[model samples]
Target: MNKNLYIFKNKKRYRVNVRNYNQEDFEDLIDLQRKAFPPPFPPDLLWNHEQLTSHITRFSDGALCIEVDGQIAGSITSLRTNYANESHTWEQITSDGYITNHEDDGEVLYIVDICIDPDYRGLGLGKELMRAKYETVVYLGVKKLAGGSRMPGYKKVRDKLTIEAYYEKVVKGELDDPVVTFLMKSGRMPERLMKNYLEDEDSADCAVLMIWKNPFIT
Candidate 1:
């Protein structure tokens, strides 16, 4: 795979390249994930080097890393799954975080995880990564992209509103939940609300099912 498949420029004019993950990137990617999603979740929920290696070994192009100034700044891991009309929880799609659920002939590109280093936030790298994923969809000839959006802001209002209510507010622009807001702006439509999606405190044990149809696919 070409290491320079995708490239972007941050506001500060730094070059950021999205490329296939290499074995050397394991530790750095682990560190980035730690910083991007700190505690509150069990250690088992967090991916380790071995698990990531398994993913890359199974499907090489399914994982990507972002390089900025010669360092790994962010990474996104995805898998291909058969197109299903119904919604899927994170555990169901990813097989309880094992990530062995990937299928090469699947019809949909499932975005398992995308993380940007905290220091790299606000530089539009996340959006650039999303674009890279769309390119992956086209490369894999998938019909669409699907994933569960973590509601990082849900815990704040979990007491006052139900998960469905909060999802409606976020979709209607009545709330500013970061993850959901980004997905909406990126053209991903909400499909349903997933209960106990993951072990994240920020999401309040819920996630919003999101889908982005590929215009180029048919």
Candidate 2:
């Protein structure tokens, strides 16, 4: 709620701006995606301005773009779904006779994507991007926030305890990530969801599905 409109850091300080996407915004959006990911998504997905607009238009509250010095530096997309009665949010888990959760007006906000240019790493851009999505979801009266995050490797071992440790001790439900430290700090992620895996040639990459219940506006 600073409303001062920018986060001032050292030399590489970055400010995040949230705005609805226009058809003209596709190229820069795709460029931002390429700069953010290791294996960037296909550019053909947003081949034209119209294609970008169509993607943005699918969100319940529309997509948001983050700009640093008048250029697109990052972006986030959120989806609102009627999961009021559905026990499981994952499409892979839902089954027949599963009383389809009816929002009856209630809805859950799913953060589909959050990305930041590599050049902007260590500047807290990813955290800001997440905060933006959280604020937006709160404004929309969503009751739960959820997402799936990819781990670097399936069986990768770390000298560190785990991402969950950090989540439990530091963040304390204020934030969450698939990395065990952050996710555990934010909230406990269900093992049932965490164990869900995909096959890879060398090793399978583990993904953790996380959920944070909104204490406010519920």
Candidate 3:
């Protein structure tokens, strides 16, 4: 892993830092989940101390955090694995987010978690965190960046539109899904939609399978 750190200044002039997350960041990271995922999303799904430790212990480079003025504002967690079974659910692939399935030499960098603090929106931190993930693909010599993005905004439109219609509109920018739209802007292309991909009720338990191929594939 390159251990490269990315820095910038947001509109408010707060220094933003994108770098690897350590055990000391567990508190901020956990609080971030409370703000990012809240109610309907299972609280159990949030990163626990054990899980945070597992991330760094198993693959430190796969865990990155974005800080603003030294305050953790965003996080992205990934694992290395091949996309053999498209039918696999989030729990199966990530061992319920513990990332126990981490494969050192897997072909793809599978992002299981990406969230920005609700207070930190409009800062482009999500995109920057994604850039770090893309960088991980290159630095770790992986094949691509892949993940099943949530559609938190789907629930709001479910009554007015079908799932397909919702997805289509989001892709066309006629509509916006919190996670899906953000990932799209970060250069991830939606490949397909899968049911029961996650336990997220906000997304109607559906997920958009997305990916970004590495241009410099070795």
Pick the lDDT winner: 3
- Please identify which of the two predictions, 1 or 3, would achieve the higher lDDT against the true structure: 3
Q: Between the candidate structures 1 and 2, which one is better when assessed by lDDT?
A: 1
| Every model's TM-score | 0.91, 0.65, 0.92
Worst 10 residues of 3 by lDDT: 2-11
Backbone clash tally (model 3):
0
Sort all candidates by TM-score, best to worst. Answer: 3, 1, 2
Q: Measured by TM-score, how close is model 3 to the native structure?
A: 0.92
Query: In candidate 2, residue 55 scores what lDDT?
Result: 46
Arrange candidates, best lDDT first. Answer: 3, 1, 2
Per-residue alpha-carbon lDDT of candidate 2 for residues 29-95, written as tens digits (9 for 90 to 100): 7777766654333343222454355445544353677677677777766556564233342333321
| lDDT (CA) per prediction | 0.81, 0.51, 0.85
Q: In angstroms, how far off is 147's CA in candidate 2?
A: 0.7
**Model 1 C-alpha lDDT versus the unseen true structure:** 0.81
Q: List the residue pairs that clash in candidate 1.
A: none
Model 3 clash pairs? none
lDDT of 1 by residue, 1-218 (tens): 33453344453466677888978888888888888887775667777877788778877787888887778888888888884456566788887656787788989888889998999777777877888888888877789988888998888998899888999999889998989999888778988888887778878788888888889866
Q: What is the lDDT of residue 51 in candidate 3?
A: 91
| Stretches of candidate 1 exceeding 4 Å from the true structure | 1-11
Better of 1 and 3 by TM-score: 3
